[model samples]
Target: MSSPIFTTPDEVEAAFYAALAHADLDRMMAIWSEDDEVVCVHPGSIRLIGLVAIRESWRQLFASGARITVSATHPVRWSNLMTAVHTVHQHVHVEGDDRLHPPIIATNVFARGALGWKMVMHHASPAPDMDNLHSNDSPHIIH
Candidate 1:
């Protein structure tokens, strides 16, 4: 199949999840540029910089037996012709019998380069207790 080209931040975000669903490493890397400034951070994991590190990280994850299903919500976006940033919360559900994994919060950044919009950064972390705790009054609270 042809490589992915991100015309918009939303498209890139969608491709990211699609790649995960298929566990297609090449398709996943297509969302990112080969630039040295590219960065990625999986939930509770250290930051990975440059194409080599980022690719390796994803390669490992894809190699793992677990399959991930991600749902994104509340996208806060900012952009110009050359750069775009999206702060989103991802609810990750792992396939198989295990049902105890918690959701993750992620901040994903993209940039326009020679090819197209390529992901520049993805910083994900486990949500704090307060963020996860049930609160009836807050409509923004993730279930």
Candidate 2:
């Protein structure tokens, strides 16, 4: 795989969502680093490690009936020449209704490898309110 010249973190982020929107498993996997150390934690799920597990997990998710849309906000970024990290809040909206899904906080880590910027870690979890219950925010529509 050739290295992708990612000019901005937003570009990498956009590609990640675009891949999910299309349910293109290969394209989605391409964004990740080819290493066993890579990690992904879906909302309300246990941490998934390595490329194979991550790929299978996404495959299962994409195979589900519902279509998902993700809107991102409040991104915090850290980077060096070889790596970058982005922590963003995702407001997910499932199709068929206007109801809001629980908000997700994700820590996405990327490494500049032979294949350019590849995601190494994606740790996502549901946001807990001050009372310890899930947050009660309205779903945000992506424009």
Candidate 3:
């Protein structure tokens, strides 16, 4: 079956996290652009470039049979006409794992092509330890 043409970068990002949680490699790859310049960086791992390398890496990971739950928050987005960039704080949980892992900082870049908005790059890294993720000096109300 042909993959859905994602209409927005936000949709692609949503699908990306859903795929990650389910270990759906095909769904994950579908969100990525079909360009030779596409890139992905798994935490603590070397960068993987192009569709072939990225697919192989994901295939290996999904083979482990581990389910990962990803929760992303604190998004910062930038966009012009053809490209968009989104950065967010990521919290990941492994099924059956007791210990909590540090949060990840992720950046996702997307470009509008004939197939609509497709992700061109995803880079994730460990976030720095902070005393609190919430601000103590500011009001908690959303404006």
> Per-prediction TM-score, please?
0.85, 0.83, 0.89
lDDT of model 2, residue 90: 90
* lDDT score at residue 84, model 3, on the 0-100 scale: 99
Positional deviation of residue 48's Cα in model 2 after best superposition, in angstroms = 1.1
Give a tens-digit lDDT track for model 2, residues 49-93.
999999999999999866778888999999998888999899887
Q: Any runs in candidate 3 off by more than 4 Å, and if so which? A: 131-143
Q: Tell how far residue 30 is off in model 1, in angstroms.
A: 0.7
Deviation from native of the Cα of residue 118 in model 3, angstroms: 0.5
Q: Largest TM-score belongs to which candidate?
A: 3
Winner by lDDT: 3
Candidate order, lDDT descending:
3, 1, 2
* Candidate 2 TM-score over all chains jointly: 0.83
User: Local error of candidate 3 at 29, Å?
Assistant: 0.8
- The better-scoring model by lDDT among 2 and 3 is 3
lDDT of 2: 0.81
What is candidate 1's TM-score against the reference? 0.85
Clashes of each: 0, 0, 0
lDDT to native, each model? 0.83, 0.81, 0.92
